[model samples]
Target: MITNFLLDHSALVPVAILLVALVCAVLGLLFADRRRILWALAGVSSLPVFALTLVPTVHTIDEILCTVQFSVPTLGAVELLANVALFLPPVCFAALASRRPVTMLAAGSVLSAVIETLQALVPAIGRACDTNDWLMNTIGAVLGALIAAGTAWLVDRRAQSGSSTGAISS
Candidate 1:
């Protein structure tokens, strides 16, 4: 079943993933600040988003149409999970890379919607636009934003505690 997925999908997926990794490594070297590095990573992470969704794949339908189906639980667990995982890392890096998690979340949500719209409007992409995919992606983005916020809070709490002890010692 897993191998069947590759038959219809673009063969360049593995190559794209590797290329994204290389780009991230290159960007990491160029950025000095931690937040800047994270932002670069976030941008690099979005490569897969386009590679996966926009790449032309083998299609059975001869006619191209733009249609959106509402979120339906018809997809298999694996496909659903994959959709969610797709957006998670990018948004996580984006939120962590910036002072504004909400802005990142909004951007992520809009990105998801735009991707879906592209799939619908562009027939050459050989991908169907589905609301379920957008919904799952948004959920993943939300989770990523929450994780970033939580991580920042924890780090701040630790730093504040350490500073308090240092101040007392002084």
Candidate 2:
């Protein structure tokens, strides 16, 4: 039934839900006067995805640690890319919501560090805490924050230009 489907696509389920939630949150932010709530939702939405990323598929820790290990070359590159994607959206949302790039960057760093530490300490989670993963996640968050800042700047510039042009015409 539904359980069979979820079992088959466990990795995809949370990511899909997160993507859907992100779209809804963005749409809500567009119409809502109180954007902070939507921003908070955006921030909180990462939790389930994070948990899914750490979830142990097996009762044994061996597979978990091995799967999360840091490697170089083709597989490593792919894993690093996945980590970047995982952290990017949450950081972008945080930066956009708070309008503070530095804060978002710091928050993203701390969050990644904490997740890694927890994974290393918690045997039940059965996930490896690789420094490489932490580094990649932080990089992604910083990039997201930078992108958000740039977008805000562009928007403000456009708004200013529009106002000035209207004033000149008037």
Candidate 3:
């Protein structure tokens, strides 16, 4: 039955889809010079994965605990750290790779929020879409963006200083 199928692998299906998308985004960013287009594509690609988190299901607290336990020993820490970790790296990478930090951060945050909302809708996920998650995700993305900005600034400053000193003069 459709219900049975949804029950059996719903969690995994979404996670798998998202993971594939993430991989593709990373590959595209790394190989492609069209940074803006890649960023936009990455942003758009995250939506369905996030939305999957929101789908209603029969998840119980015990189920959530089991999932967390397999990956991390401490459930409490996982709740706090997992989402932040999940969100931060890609945001950082995207921001660093792209010319537009604000746009990347905004897109990442929005996608995260959408995922949280979708998760909230899924009663089976056993996790409510908390405003706290959104806030934390946004903060993580901002931190990533700041790091990217700092790196860019340092690179630019070094380049300018080098040019002024004719470091490359033949």
TM-score of each: 0.74, 0.68, 0.53
Please rank every candidate by TM-score, starting with the best.
1, 2, 3
**lDDT winner between candidates 1 and 3:** 1
Against the true structure, whose lDDT is highest?
1
The C-alpha lDDT values of all candidates are 0.68, 0.65, 0.56
Q: Tell me the spans in candidate 2 whose CA falls farther than 4 Å from its real position.
A: 1-34, 37-41, 62-76
The weakest ten consecutive residues by lDDT in model 2 span 66-75
User: Model 1, residue 79: what's the lDDT?
Assistant: 55
Instruction: Please give me the total number of clashing residue pairs in predicted model 1.
Output: 0
Let me know the TM-score candidate 3 reaches against the reference structure.
0.53
Tens digit of per-residue lDDT, candidate 1, span 1-170: 44357335645444433453344333433331488778777887789888888888887334455555555433344455556657766876777778567888899999999988878777776888878888878876876666666666666676789999999999
lDDT, residue 19, model 2: 65
Cα lDDT over the full model 3: 0.56
Model 3 bad stretches (over 4 Å) = 1-78, 124-127, 167-170
Model 2: per-residue Cα lDDT over 1-170, one tens digit each: 53356456556544643464456435444523445864885568587557755677575464434225454423224456566656766776677677787898899889888888777777687677788888778876876677667656665676789999999999
